[model samples]
Target: MDTKGIEQMLSVLRSTATQASGNVQESGPANAGGVDFAQVLQNSIDKVNQTQKQADQMAEKLAAGDTSQNLHEVMIALQTASVSFQEMVQVRNKLVTAYQDVMNMQV
Candidate 1:
C-alpha cells in the first residue's frame, strides 16, 4: 500500500474512534436519542463486511481477466480487508475477556 492509502486508513480509524467515544460520552441518562452500543458494534461489523465483499469482488474480476482492474489496487483492497478482519477479531476477543472478567468479579 502507498503512504497515501495508509494515511487515509489511519484518518478513518481515528475518526471512527473519536465518533464512538463521543457517542459514549453523550449517551447519558438525559440523551433520549443517544446511540446504542450494540448498534455501533453492528455498524462497524457491517462496514468490515462491506469491505471484504468489495475485495472479494475485485479479486474475482481480476481472476476473470478484467482489463480495467489494476493489480495493485486489488492487492491493496485484499490486504485492507484482511487487516480489518483481524482487528475486528481482536476487538471481539477483548470484549469477551472483559465480559468474562466482569462476570467473575465478586459483588
Candidate 2:
C-alpha cells in the first residue's frame, strides 16, 4: 500500500508542532518545505473516492456480464479501494487524537 501521503502529513504535523513550541522560527511560510496539509488531505480523500468509484463501476460492469471486465480485476479494484479507505480512516483518527492532545495542553 502507498504510504507517502500519510508520511508527508505526519512530517508536516511534527514540523508545525515544533514550530508552535518555538523550536523553529516563523520567518517564512508556515509549511515552507512541504505541501499544504489541507491540500494533501483533500487529494488523499479524492484519490480514495476515485478508487471507490472505479471499483464500483468495475463491479457493475462485471455484474452486467461485460466481457471486457475481468473478475480478478474487479476484485482487485474493490480491495484497493477498501484498503485506501481504511488507511484514510486511520489517518483521521490520528489527527483527531493530536487535536485533542493539543487542546489538553497547558498554556
Candidate 3:
C-alpha cells in the first residue's frame, strides 16, 4: 500500500471539500444561490465523470485479457473509482438534505 499516495489523495479531497462549501457564498435573495450550487455540483460531477471514464477504459483493457496490464492494478483502480462515485452521491444527498432543512426553517 502506498500510504503516501493515500495521504496525498486525502489532502486533495479535504481541500476540495473546503472549496466547494466556500463557493456557496450568497449575495442576495435575487441570486437564489442556485448558480453557485450548480457550479460546485457540476464541478464535482465532472470529476466523477472523469473517473468513470478512466475506469471504463481500464475495464475494457482488462476484459480484453491484456497480460501486460496487471490485473490487480486494474481492479484496484475500478474499486477506487466506484467508491469515489459513491462518496460523491452521498455528498450530493447530504447537500440536498441540508438545503431542504434550511428551506423548512421558519425564520
* Residue 17, candidate 1: C-alpha displacement in angstroms: 17
Give the worst 10-residue stretch by lDDT in candidate 1. 1-10
Which parts of model 1 have CA positions greater than 4 angstroms off?
Answer: 1-33
Model 2: per-residue lDDT, tens digit, 1-107? 66787888888898778976779865568546657899888888888899999999999999999999999999999999999999899999999998998889888
Task: Supply the TM-score for candidate 2.
Answer: 0.88
Model 3 weakest 10-residue run by lDDT:
1-10
Steric collisions counted per model: 0, 0, 0
Candidate 3: residue pairs that collide = none
lDDT at 74, model 1: 100
Off by over 4 Å in 3: 1-37
What digit string (tens of lDDT, one per residue) describes model 3 on residues 41-79?
A: 566677778878887888898889877677888888788
Tens-digit lDDT string for candidate 1 (1-107): 22333344345445445654455445457756544566666767787899999999999999999999999999999999999888778767866775676578666
> Each model's TM-score?
0.71, 0.88, 0.61
Prediction 1 global C-alpha lDDT: 0.72
Scored by TM-score, the top model is 2
Error of 1 at 104 (Å): 0.4
